[model samples]
Target: MTNMMIYNELTAICGENNVFIDEPMSHHTLTKIGGKADVFVTPQTYEQVADVVRLNANYHLPFMLLGNGSNMIVKDGGVRGLVMYMSHLSSVRVEGTQLTAQGGAGIIHAAQIALEHSLTGLEFACGIPGSVGGAMVMNAGAYGGEVKDVIDHVKAVTPTGDLVILNKEDLALDYRTSIIGKKHYIVLEAVFKLEKGDAAEIKEKMADLTYRRESKQPLEYPSVGSVFKRPPGYFAGKLIQDSGLQGKGVGGAEVSTKHAGFIVNKNNATAADYIATIDMVRETVKQTFGVELELEAKIVGEDLTETAD
Candidate 1:
């Protein structure tokens, strides 16, 4: 399978501990479904990531970046070549009201960091499960607050391995997108400027938001949170509910009867099953509203062979 050659190359670059062969994506992904990545590499620093990129260029090996796996789905057939997980890059530092987060830092963790610094702007992310890199790339927002609103600048490695800093204005963040993820830019870190607030008040607000999220969302189930973006004036969940798609699905991947927005893997659902349910929901929503609801979650990798079962 040319596995040895691939392993040797990876081990030569990042050593044995950092490289994993056929690592299961099910455990890593939020939905807890899918096959394995051919090779999974978790680099601890931006320099290591850059080095990996350079190695990929040398070997002409295929590769892709991964964050928290919240807003994404890898098909049941699994991903080919190198899958670089950003989790190892976690670091969050607050200097006064300004915060700097390593790309792989969870938004929830970043929110906590902000709270520890008595910062108020990151309260919206107190409940988010995505990484700072993914959040920045997608211009992630919730409850009237957005990453774009607070992010002052970002540091990233380009496709050609050039490190650069892009200011907030340069990111061109809007809606659910930014230049980084689109342009194939690899985010290394992000700097956010927040406001000083009472630490007690910040903690109280975060707690309130967390409670509200737990009460409203399907927190117990394994699923990608918020399957679709808000479509202009209408909420995606509301539209699906109004269309009578609540609790409907292709297999074990059922639309949450609790929320109607989330497609949860209630049983041992396959990524194929999850995707089939996603398709059904989209089609039904399109037919009913003629709105052609867009998926917020990123769907990638090869299609499944035994998809029906």
Candidate 2:
């Protein structure tokens, strides 16, 4: 579709405040990186988002459903479709021991809401940076707990743009993957099952987790958390450190001096720099350890330069 047509149709479907033409993708991402999208939409409600999706599908135009941009990297060339930010979809409610939360809600927010009601089980999500949809889609976990442990059911929009509900068993949750990919469902809301617990104890666990994160991670720097996935029997950081690659980088993107697993922006790094650093890490680790290092975070869009220094 033409730019004018895309704008006209989107504006007609959603109000002016809900859409942007050629929105800069960097501002929407957690890594403070990347380029721009042809168009961006922040639908005011789930129905509005669904309407946008249905309309796009009808036209056969490209569209990408975005969460918090926690687990993705939009490339320097940007995305070639309508990028939707679901932050405004956030809502949370409690029904007895179950918490029903919108996908846009962060897991930490859910954990806090659970803590307020003295609900346990979400204490493991204390510092997870992704949204509930992000956490659910990837089964995001930390400190020995995962989404599969508490999720009950999910309401979502399927690939064909129809809404559907799936029980916990249907998600096929595993290490950082879900049925959302195979089933192509865009999560709208999720219900979590939790047990009653002491509010003080729950807070204590969250605090402890927060302390550990602050002390161990290079939180002061801009990064995407762990850059590489753990190999079968070896941690990504340990292998990187053993291979003598800590603090190495391409341009301003460097493997953090404080933590080997993090590739950080040391001096205004670009998306190219980040990509270069990642490539070097992958190649170097494979050469040194004889094991391929897989990326935990998703890299999207296209590199403006085929070769970035």
Candidate 3:
């Protein structure tokens, strides 16, 4: 189909207001760097999301799902087909000790809801900057708690746009990884099993975690928090610090002085600059410690040079 046809179809499926052409990916990612997306769609409902997925499948168009873009870095060349932004689908509900949150609901917001209901299990997630779906995809966690520990089940749409309910066992959640991405499942909702606890205690715990995060992380700058996954027997931040990589980077992108694990957009950094900084850190660490540091942040889209070629 032509670009016009695709736009019209997308508008028909969603609405004209929900679709955009040549949308800036920098506006959608945490790093505040990237080019543009050929098409971007904000689906307000689960059915709309499913339909958008099906449409992309039918047209053989490439697509990527976006939550809060908390852990993603889009490249300078931007993305080709569709970019589905799910933030509008956010909704959280509580019943007894079970908290059900829509895919787009902020994980932090869900934690707050749990606290409001005197739920304790989600206290650790109070500082995680991700959407429920994104959290489920990577089993996001902090302060010695993981999403897998509290998630009971998830409702997601498969790559074929068919919905499926997956129990915790089927999710295959591990340290910063899950089957959700491998299976190309777009999360619709998640059910968390939390324990009832004293609201005061929960609030206190959340406050403590928040303080730790704000104090340690480079929250003032734009960044894809925690650049590398922790290697066995060593923390990524400690390793980066040991390598003396902190306070250094390419262009406006720099390894955060506050936390070595973070690569911040200290100035108006380009995606290339950010990626180059990541590479420099990775190479430096590999040479220094003989440890291959795997990335925690997801890199997407294409580079500007590639687009020009």
Best by TM-score: 3
TM-score of each model, in listed order: 0.96, 0.96, 0.98
Q: Superpose all Cα atoms of candidate 1 onto the true structure and report the RMSD in Å to 1 decimal.
A: 2.0
Task: Encode model 1's per-residue lDDT on 42-142: one tens digit a residue.
Answer: 88878888888887767767788898988888898888888889988989998878999999999999999898888989999999999999998889988
Residue 302 alpha-carbon offset, candidate 2, angstroms: 2.0
Deviating ranges (above 4 Å) for candidate 1: 306-309
lDDT (Cα, tens digit) per residue for candidate 2, span 85-179:
88998898998999999989988899999999999999989898888988888898899999999999999987667888989898999998899
Question: Which lDDT values do the candidates have, in the order given?
Answer: 0.88, 0.86, 0.93
Query: Which ranges of candidate 3 are over 4 A from the true structure?
Result: none
Lowest summed lDDT over 10 consecutive residues: which window, candidate 2?
Answer: 300-309
Residue 3, candidate 2: how far off, in angstroms?
2.2
Clashing pairs in 3: none
Candidate 3 RMSD to the correct structure: 0.8
Please give the lDDT score at residue 166 for candidate 2: 89
Arrange candidates by TM-score, descending.
3, 2, 1
Count of backbone collisions within predicted model 1: 0
Report the Cα lDDT for candidate 3: 0.93
Can you give the lDDT of residue 302 in candidate 2?
67
